[model samples]
Target: MKIKTLAIALCLFSLPFAASANPTLLEKTRQEQQIQKTHNAEREAGFKLTEKEVRAKRNALIAERNRLQRETELLSKSFSKNENKLAKLEEQLRLETGSLGELFGVVRQAAKELDTEMAFSVTGADHSNYDAVVNEIVAAKALPSITQLNGLWLGMTEQIQASTELRQVSVPFINGEGHQSVVQAYRLGSMGLIADQGYISWDGKRHVATPYLKQPENGPSVSVMSQLNESGLQAVVVDPSRGVMLEQLANSPELKDRIEHGGVVGKIILGLLAVGAVIALFRGVKLMMIRQQIKAQLKNPTKPGNNPLGRVLNVYSKAQNRSVEALELRLLETIVDEQQGLEKGLSMLKLLAALAPMLGLLGTVTGMIETFQVITQFGNGDPTVMAGGISMALVTTVLGLVSAMPLLLAHNVLSTQADNIRNILEKQGISLVAEQAEKAGSAA
Candidate 1:
């Protein structure tokens, strides 16, 4: 039994060795279970890692969506701001294109016209903003502001007011000889632009004062325009029509020109005046001498026939023997012959005085006809051609009137003197004839 028990223990020990030779089912299953447990643990660990990765991806998606939403909001705000800006811009465009645009057009037009006016206007030339303002206005797209409009108004008003005023300025002058000089220019409104009594033209491109070809005799004399005061000049000359009217007046023919233009008719009138004056002088001298002789002869009645009264008395004495009727006839014949001598040259003087005016009229008619002829040929275009004839007409008329008045006065004086002498002779002859008749009666 002990052996049997030992063998059984051996067998038990050997059986454990024999079983260790091949894996036990429980051990294999445990091993398989351990491997499965390891696989499961590894899978769970991998799944937990995958879950962390999945969470990270989900968080990234959420973050991306949130960022997209924020960007959308910002874009909407930007669109809203852009729309408001466009609405305001449209309103501004409407305002600019409205009546304000028309007003700008009017202002620009006025500025342009005013600029031209100021260029020729003497009064406001020194204070004009014409060129700069015109350029500014031309480039502008919008209406001018109140300040700009006020400047325009002032420019226009000042120009108008300045044109009416007289002001002096410094200027460069060009003479007829093409010489240039500086001067204190005078602007006498519309009358003339003068400096040192010479006219200047403003219509030319060069702003140079120019002298007339023939200056006026009565220039802007110091006597005409008072001497300049200490404060400023009293007056100046300005050219409205440039130098048209004043130049024509200055170029008008003078007295020397008149004689030249008056031609032959004018000379004839002058000759008559001269002859009438000479004859008057001669007649006056002759009458004075005759009166002296007659007055002396009256003192001594015996003095023979030197003067008219003396001759008549002598004739009556010589006719003493004849009857009263015969004696009267002889006295009448002698008085008539003496009257002829006293009235000598008086008729000629009167004729010349009357003829002078008629001749002048004839000359004037001829001059007018000549002027018309020139007009017909030249279409009245040249004033210079017409001026000569006009001058002739005026001069001849003036000459005729001047000659006639003096000649008429001279003839009247001589006639009155001759009449007085004739009356005296007649009275003396009558007295002498009556004495002779009385003597005859007494003798009978």
Candidate 2:
């Protein structure tokens, strides 16, 4: 009976313990299974969301692609429309080509038919009208190119018709000054106009338009000169020895009459200038004379008042007994006087020398003016006409320099001699006074 009770009690304790463990284990297993289910649901939801977003993005991309396709189609259509417009323009140009050419031809013909006289009556016809004509020819589209030949022919035809009408209407010749000229120019024929001014060809070569003035078999030759008229327009005979045609004319007898008159006037003016030059040179001559007198004094020691040095020596001789202070004062006075004399007219000489250059400059100006005048009267057709003025200009400059150089040398030499004489006078005066003092003191 005791063993059975013990066994039953042990069984009862074990049952409670097992029952508590069972509930706890059940709760743990339920928690773990619930967590697993929750995780699986979350994973499925995430995957579904990802698929949804991907599908949405794909749909958006498809819509965008459709929109781009529509834009591309519209752009292509626009390009086709532009191409059609260009094609239409090109076709129109092709169809109008003939008509435009015919129109240009008619315009050209009308331009040719209209006389310059009629155009003048209409007024405002000039180079601008000609340019319009040329433009019309250019735009004709008849030929592949509006060649120079075609232009020449068209220009000639128009000019002939216009000139003929102008001649009939008594039109005046036009000059550069906007006035009528006396000389009448016809065509560039051998008989009518002498020659057109030769032009530089396309290859930079000179092309003489007129065949009448042919080169001599040997070379170019000039004719003898005749005198020029006061107007400077007459054909003066020229010396054949001269190289150029204009030079011969300039040296012509007719030109010489005017030039000689001018030369005489120039000479008269130059004579006055020469008188002034003489006056100026007188200063130099005086200096030379003074120097010569000094030399003469040295050659003949007996001569009095010949040079500053001699004068100083004479003064010292006369005042040998004087005190050094007095002697020095006298020497200083003598030196002042001598210096004044030596420098006499030097200022005037310098002024004259300076004026020489100025005169030369004046000559240059006058010469250049003359050359420019010739150029203005005629043209730069001849260099020979200009050489005389150039020569005069250069000669004047040379003369100026030649005059100045000698004057400069003379001034330097005179200055050096003056200083030398002054020094000698001073030294001699000092010695003479000092010697006299010593002699007097010793005698006393």
Candidate 3:
């Protein structure tokens, strides 16, 4: 019984110790969780406090911004009005600074109008009294008003003065100074005066500067134009759109004479061609006569003569009683002689035909040499100057070919026909001789 009681007491005591140890561990865990909860609450309280302070600050900033915006609007309106008033005052001051003449000038320019029927007459005592004409224009009431004529007087003065200067200028551009310029001025002035006015009529009453007029005949004016022979050169008049400088052409002796007389080479070549044509015409007439004679001989076949076919026929007739072989030999000899006579100058004609192209080539070479000379002399090297030589060369070549080709053809055709006719005559002669020889033999 004692052992049982001791075991029971020990069991009871161990159970209570185990139970107490578990409760103590639970209590420590509860303490740690309480500390964590306290720390979280404190942190949350601190964050809420900071958020409230920020909200208050933001509200105050919004109120301040609204107040500033309102003030800025009021200032902008005030500045705009001040700026407008200042700009107006500045414009008024600038207007006061300008002179009355300048103001009148502006108004006149703005109100001026153009009228078409304005008369512009140019009258000067000779070419030297141009100032009188300008003074007349200045005094005329037909011009624009003075206020509106700010530049009008200056412009009119220049125009009339320039017109007079141009009229007094040298006629052609022969001299160096005031040559082309004077010519151009004269031309433009004449045109301008005509356009500004209605028409231009030169007063025949010239001043002492001009000589007396030479009255022309009432009848047809005789042109002392020598017929210029331009055989080698081909020329065509170019119709210029701008007016021709006819006055200069009329005045320049050298230029006028050149136009009228043409160049030496052209004249010489033309004379040569004319002579050649005359000779050819005579030859052609002679050839026609020869052809007629040949035609008559062909039709009759009985005309006896020393001519080419005629001689051949005569030889054949003589050998009528002889053997055919002997007659044929005689006929052959006669035909040969006739052929030589017919072909007398044929080689010369051929030589002439061949020489045409060679002459053209010579012309080409000479033209090129001239072109080179021009290049060497002035070195202007203008294609227009060089083109003259080139055109001459090409024209000569074309002329040569044109002349030679037809002549060569005619020579060849005539020679061939002559040869054929000669051959036929010889054949007839031989046949007649052969027949006669055969008859003689048979008779023997």
- Most accurate candidate by lDDT: 1
Local error of candidate 1 at residue 218 (angstroms)? 7.2
Candidate 2 error regions (>4 Å): 1-307, 317-322, 436-444
lDDT of each: 0.77, 0.53, 0.51
Q: Candidate 1: worst 10 consecutive residues by lDDT?
A: 222-231
The sequence of per-residue lDDT tens digits that candidate 1 reaches over residues 157-196 is: 7766666655676777766777887867666553456666
lDDT for model 3 comes to 0.51
How many residue pairs clash per model? 7, 17, 4
The worst-scoring run of ten residues by lDDT in candidate 3 lies at 219-228
Write down the TM-score of every candidate. Answer: 0.58, 0.34, 0.44
lDDT of 3 by residue, 1-444 (tens): 999999999988886576686988767778999999999999999999999999999999999999999999999999999999999987886677557545544443432311110122232222332343333434444433554354444444554565433242222222223232112112223322111111112322321111112211221111110111224232322112211232233344443343232233433334444444454445455455555666666676777654555666777677676666677778778778767755555565566567666766766677678778878886865786676666566656655665567557656755665576667666667666766867887888
Against the true structure, whose TM-score is highest? 1
Per-residue alpha-carbon lDDT of candidate 2 for residues 47-139, written as tens digits (9 for 90 to 100): 999999999999999999999999999999999999999999989876878576565566556544443322322111221235444554545
> Which order, best to worst by TM-score?
1, 3, 2
Worst 10 residues of 2 by lDDT: 199-208
